[model samples]
Target: MYDLHCHLLPAIDDGPADLETSLEMARMAVADGITTVACTPHIYPGVYENTAYGIRAAIRAFQCELDQRGIALRLVEGADVHLAPDLIEGIQAGRIPTIAGSRYLLLEPPHHVAPPRFEETVFDLMVAGLVPVITHPERLSWIETHFDLFERLAMRGAWMQITAGALTGRFGKRVKYWSERFVGDGMCMIIATDAHHPRRRPPCLMEAREAAGALVGGEEATNQVVIRPRGIVNDVPPSDLPAAALRTCPRDQRNANGPIRASVFGRLLGRKTGV
Candidate 1:
């Protein structure tokens, strides 16, 4: 499996604090079944200004460590870019790091609300010929509130990625519901760990798979979601879902502010229940 989002770089952001921790996280990832991980530190305007060159250097250094340790996991470059107006300009100037240097960019939106400039950002990415693979839309306020917005973005050719923890109910019940619903409806194209550490935010997608299996009544659909995400990073197309099988959250269920009430309930309940 491939962990599309992670803070594995030493002291870059809210990830590992040192090289040893980074290595330990990598080892844990492989042990938990992740083979490739994108070192996506925050790259919005103010949070973490991780440039492509710096990100590459980090990946190279991490790769060297992996090689020295004889670890088989591959380290790739990506940016968990925060949503900001200037981001589009950065991408055009080659300041933002694409996933594996592919056209796909891992975009991170604001935590509490969807920025009004989101559509414009997508337009900017399109203008620069970059395919924006939205990272962890399940956590975004926009998707939580306005489910149709996702369909609109998908219509605009942007792909969606859900965090592995969200699938396993690690993010609470609302996230699980969103993740499962999106995967089941074919609204989601990839499932990544988005891991940050060995324990606090460990790397694992088993819970996501379990949830997918339960929802889809089989493993094929769930596996398809997990496999295609890595394929996108590797420049492979995802398995196309049949029109009839695809689903969208009911209009009434979507949130205009952020997550729907069900999601809030699920999350609250999940927190209360704990993992």
Candidate 2:
């Protein structure tokens, strides 16, 4: 299987801190049944600032080490770019590398929320004749709150990627709920590991695929979801969302206790209010 988003490159971003850790992570990925992975180090302007030349050089160096170590996994070059006003321009000027040299850019929206210019940036990328493959939409609060945004993004040629851990509920129930919704809505195009380390964020694509099967059923359905992501690196469109029933999840998880008053705050407020 092809993992579209991964931070296996050492000393680049918040992934493995050194080469030893990266090699271990790579070994873990191979063991987990992932044959290919796109090394998506951060090219976000403010946070990482990695250029295509720098990324290519890093990937080449890493590949040499892999060959020497006899690791069979193939590494591809790409960037996890945060939406910037100059992003579309940078792509046009050949500054940013597309995923595996495809027309797709593995876009990383802001952590707390989808960026305000998110839709416009996607539209711009489409107008620039490139496809915008958004990474981990399940983690975004905006997408969780408003499912229509996902449909809108998809309609605008933006594809959604859900993290493997999210599907396994490693991120928490809310994230899992949103992820399941996307899968059901035919909004999710790919499920990737996004693994950073060997222990905490290990390669578990197989586990994720198994969970998807339990929830969605069959290997073909799961592969249809996963293959499109790998195809991005080769400049292929992901297969259409399957017409099977998406797993159901609760829409509202609110409680009747008025935000379920926190213990410490409740004690302090109780003393103050004499209740």
Candidate 3:
């Protein structure tokens, strides 16, 4: 399986503090069936302050360590980018790292509060050519009041990701409810381990996959971990993958934000290419 969002780099943020712990996380991920993991650290402005250059450098060094120790896991570049005013500029200037350098990126909204123009920012990003993969929206503190906003975003074009742990009830009842809703409603496209530590937030997705299989069919559950994630890392257009919004909810499969010039994601690509 492919874990498109993970905090595996050492001392880079709230993740592991040293290389040993990072290596141990890698082992845990490998054992859990995640062969490829995107080393996505936080890019909160004054907090993490992680840059594409620094993240890539850290990944290269960490990957080298893994190789020396015979760990088969592959690391790629990504960032849990907080909603910033300069987001478009950062991506345009190459300061922000997308998943595996693909056109898709993980956009993390503030957990505590719902900011202004949140939906507009997400739409603007899709128009600007980057597919905003909203990370772990099910766990957002204000999700209860923003369910309609989320549905609108999904209908428009944004991709939503639910954390793997949330599906297995690691975060408690409310969070698991939202996660299951996202899965059963076909609002979430990916299930990623936003893993921080080996125990506190370990890199595990199998339980979530099983839980998803129970909610959705086993095939759709497989798509979350294997098919859709594989397509994103390879830069495949979103239309090519199974439409998440169309699974159980037909309303979101169409353009909720007016007309589209082409396929939901093909418009971003300017062409139709297949995997």
* Number of the top lDDT candidate: 3
lDDT of 1 by residue, 159-190 (tens): 77778788787888887788877766556666
User: Which 10 residues in a row give candidate 3 its minimum summed lDDT?
Assistant: 258-267
Clashes of 1: 5
lDDT of each model, Cα atoms only? 0.71, 0.75, 0.87
TM-score of 2: 0.84
Against the hidden true structure, what lDDT does model 2 obtain? Answer: 0.75
Candidate 3 segments whose C-alpha is farther than 4 A from its true place:
245-275
- TM per candidate: 0.81, 0.84, 0.89
Among these predictions, the greatest TM-score belongs to: 3
Report the C-alpha lDDT of model 3 over 217-259, residue by residue, as the tens digit.
5777888999999998899998788865222223354355521
Worst lDDT window (10 residues) for model 2?
A: 258-267
lDDT of 1 at 217: 34
Candidate 2 per-residue lDDT, tens place, 1-275, comes to 88878999999998999999999999988998888888988887777888888889999999999999999989998888877778887877878988888888888887786567667778888888887878888888776566666677775557777898998888999889887766655566678888888888887788778777665455433553455765676676533433223333233532443112121222223421110
Each prediction's total of clashing residue pairs, residues at least 3 apart in sequence or on different chains, is 5, 1, 0
Clashing pairs in 2: 228-238
